[model samples]
Target: MVKKMMQRILPRAFLGKPSLLRRSATASQSTLAQTVQENEPVLPKMPPFDYTPPPYTGPSAEEILSKRQQFLSPAVFHFFKNPLNLVDGKMQYLFDENGKRYLDAFGGIATVCCGHCHPKVVDAIVNQTKRLQHSTILYLNPAIADFAEALASKFPGDLKVVFFTNSGTEANELALLMARLYTGCQDVISIRNGYHGNAAGTMGATAQSSYKFNVVQLLMPSIHLTFISSFACVSKTGVHHAQNPDQYRGIFGSDGSKYARDVDDIITYGTSGRVAAFIGEAIQGVGGIMELAPGYLPSVYNTIRKAGGVCIADEVQSGFARTGSHFWGFEAHGVVPDIVTMAKGIGNGIPLGAVVTTPEIAKVLAHRSYFNTFGGNPVCTAAGHAVLQVIEQESLQQNAFTVGSYLKQRLTSLKDKYEIIGDVRGRGLMLGVELVTDRQLKTPAKVETLHLVDQIKDFLVDVMDYTLSKM
Candidate 1:
């Protein structure tokens, strides 16, 4: 049913074409080269309206880079060979120090859902900041309470209780604890290539080796007293990873049921049969915008519940109408998770996140004193409330759906044209185009992918220029 609905919404041509990848390698290479050369640089045209940025009086990018190296952790990295020293943003466009506007395609790593520095959101933050800034959860603040009510209204089912945190990591950490406390089990299941957080508990749930560090050993032994880290690695012991049921490149094509069977097998063999929770991103964000196969979640959710576990939807990157089709990504799956963890767009780039669950599950937190110092800060909540309003008033969700679908269709055309463009997948604005050398083997064309990304950057810059010239 879900597949049929998707077919109605998206072009039928966008569906799986398994044999396309099996085309002759020589013809593929020739077509790829011809397509790459023929594709001209196209820039996003600027809107035909009057707008100008305030003068930038800050230090130069070079100076900032020097200061960053000296003051910030080396772990902090920047994209591009020459990193963008972005100084200003308005809606969907970002401006560098010289006021050169560029379309923000990634949307601040998919955090700025309603656009950067949205007036309504900024006004709310400014007004709230002027009224009251700092107050802990101990005090009764209307901002937090109001925002909580507003956020809870967005979800279906009994996911009414809201717990605020400073980041997605904190939200996931809290959710993990709630699941364990409710189920009285320590084992948790997450999908390979899924990322939850960087904190000790969430770090364990995260399956990607790229994000995991040696620091897990230092934090796990002391912080997570209930779980042991000696199960080979922090992620391996208490947490189990099911194969990411990738549609384009998986053992089971688009049959989600086939991949979900692995989760059942993992529970029977990998764990002690009973578990606390099954946590996953509705659409894997940093893991290359991979969407779980259709019917995967419904099957897995039931499987986890039968194993005495709760289902957690990590919406840090996929929530808040970003997917276009649904207000929440999990809604597209036709299953409601026991717990929903959100960040990124929830605060519109502000450091805010939350875990929404049922009252019965929330009672576990009440069993012991739990607090987050700056979780529901008044200003942040006000901004969050404003973000919700902006999304509704501006009809941004509809915009995401329309624009994202059009973009995906165009990307699909590119995939059909160029063999290097192996796959283009995702929903709404949260989309990805995977590049591969040999489509048959599904080999990652790393160097070519980087080049294509550079070309995209150049094209966006050109579009910005074109828009400015017309203005």
Candidate 2:
């Protein structure tokens, strides 16, 4: 059980960290350990914590799975073959039902900004809930107002107006709606393989086929919503998918201008001359943590604006200091977007999202009786404000920069030792290691990587079993 518990904690290996090769454990996680023979590098020792969660008193994982299979949506899924029942969390670790600790490098899908159940965030939520839980936007609430000002302060240029939502899907949905209305254009463009959200507008904007359903697009309402009923089944908006500026496998080989030309062609050939918006992430987190080819954003932004389209930066995955070098991923590209949509890390695991844009663009919503019913819940806003304060107070942005650089440097060195490592890219903490069956051909070794990683994880189980017995 102890050995299995340790395998549950395998964290940095997936990110290609060299912590496996004998080093001090970071606060977050331990280095990978295998049954090393003589002359092999030793597995780093885990640091001691003066903490352990109380015994769990709940249904077992199998029982929960049985209930879920019986009652829950079939679309929902779990990670490993047997789901891990995580019950408690600290800054960089999670506790399973049996109180086994696992280093949480995943950060709850990059949502836990200050770590799980961060004290400050918890305090803020509790205190705010004690005071006031929910109030419609028609009423005044200091939490929402204060948080809006603080979040708006993080932007540049005329992106002062803020609108809050419950998730990234809502944020992106609102942003796209604003773009179409403000620009009076029907065509939208998004980068291929980028994921924005799952709502009607955003699902159409989301370019990945795997995440997209055929009928959802057709059922989505048209851009001219006021004229049409909310349930009007207008064909999906004309969303042109631009070629992904993938530096590693792209035909242009890191030449972003070449990819930018594709968007120009898309505008000329795919739609009317004018477009509603051009949306993309600086770092494609869902698309293998690939950074857009150099100079891509500036060139694309210029072309989109020339076509009278607004440029939107979808910072859902790469925002809030996840990308170490900049506070917002788009900033690293040196472009200030006309609209920016963000979530995942804004409230340190709270269900909070926001869209920031110029006052002119934001005013489009005024044309309609637009509002999120549960968007600016006081408890959520208070928690979000506390998250912003914790990020600054802890200097987590700088920590991400410094630590991410170090990890990147170490990960880069692994390419020399392993022939399968095809490419190592991304800035700061948002990094990816692509495996290839044939390095020269760059054939994706998805199965091979998964099989090999599973072996490593299983080997870790053995190592933990050995170590725990000794202890």
Candidate 3:
């Protein structure tokens, strides 16, 4: 009875052939151990943290992709041929279905500053939602007032007044309107590769052909008053695209003063002498993380101010301590803008944006009745408040400085080794690596870039498989 029970409990192979069973088990264990040991060195050591993502039991990537195709906009594109069905996120990491973890290097297109679902931010959102979810800006809400005050403290000069919006686009639109109203001018100047937004008002300011649509031109009549009415319409609220001061591939090689000369020439030749605003991203986020040439903003700001234009810094991607060295990207450039538009990281993925300017400049909106129903909603403002607190408490700005400098050094080393790496630029966490076919010509190596992305995906997959096998 004892022997029968032992045989039943043991492997079938062990019943008749103990040697075979032992060999099979030993071989399998050895193979797995060897694989784990070989690949273990490649795995990035997790930072000292207690948080772990919950298990994902959702639909597969294929199902999600199919549903997305059926229900979502056709314009909505995805990265990776095998799209990542991300189900969860934490600080600097994202988890896909099957619990495969990935380092979120892109940070949701430079939006997730504090990380995905930060505990404090989530708690604040939940608390606010439980108390009061929605309220118009017209009504007195402490959340808005509190967040506005906190946000204002981060800025320099007289940029104290705040106007809440749902996105960077709206913030920029408001900034443009303020610039137009304050200076009584129409024409605006934007850098060639700079992206402001895609809304009707901002689309004109955005120079990229890919982002612009035919409807953009059609909407201009209704959007810009100068376009419809004949009031010094020689400039016509038209957006003049200035030559981007691309140090890597520009006419002038890192000579920011030379680039600023182009702005002066643009004002002289392109627009009416006077302009509304000169708006630019300190680091062009959507324009491949391009940093402005040194001394470019100061010179341009001087020129634009002389031309009756306010210097508007679009801090949508480079704000909220993402730049590492300073609280604002403009600070790194050593120039203070008259208007600052911010979003993305401000609310830590919550839909919130703000335009900050002087009390004097912000008064332009008060001349006419203006209101936003969802702007500065209790939940969003609460989340924004928590984000600011988290940044300070966690010392994320210093982390960005330390980690970003280390990352930049490593990337610079990679650039030294690889000829395809044309340029590695950007400040702090907001960095970009551009690939080129020729070092001299600086032709974009599009195919090579795609190949590199694929290689990374494969490597990540292998690492994930190894981890799962161990588990």
Looking at model 1, which ten-residue stretch has the lowest summed lDDT?
Answer: 1-10
How many collisions between residues are there in candidate 1? 3
lDDT tens readout by residue for model 2, 1-471: 332332333333333533232322242233233312222424545456667788899999999999999999999888765568889887776788887666665687778879888889999999999989997988999999999999999999999999999999999988888887787776788999898888777888888888888764613344455675332222245687999999999889899999999999988877667787899989887788989988889999999998888999999889998887899999998999999998889988889999999999988999889978989889999998998998899999988888778767766776654456789999888888887756779989777566555545434433443443343
TM-score of 1: 0.88
> Which wins on lDDT, candidate 1 or candidate 3?
1
Off by over 4 Å in 3: 1-52, 216-233, 458-471
Per-model CA lDDT versus the true structure: 0.81, 0.78, 0.79
The TM-score measured for candidate 3 stands at 0.86
The clash count for each model shown is 3, 0, 0
lDDT for each residue of candidate 1 in 238-314, tens digit (9 for 90 to 100): 78889988999888988899899989998898776778899999899989999999999999999999988999999
The prediction achieving the highest lDDT against the true structure is 1
Q: What tens-digit string does per-residue lDDT give for candidate 3 at 1-471?
A: 212211222222122323222323244645534433443334434334455678777789999999999999999989977888898887766778876667566777788888888889999999999999996887888998999999999988899998899999999999998998888777889999889899887888998888998773412354455354333324644688999999888889788999999899988988768788899999999999899989899999999998878999999999999989998999999999999999999988999999999999988888898888888889999999999999999999998887778667666765543455679899888998897767767889787677567555644434433332332
TM-score result, candidate 2: 0.86
- RMSD of every candidate to native, in Å, equals 6.6, 7.1, 11.5
> Candidate 3, residue 168: CA error in Å?
0.5
User: Model 3 — which ten-residue stretch has the worst lDDT?
Assistant: 1-10
TM-scores of all models? 0.88, 0.86, 0.86
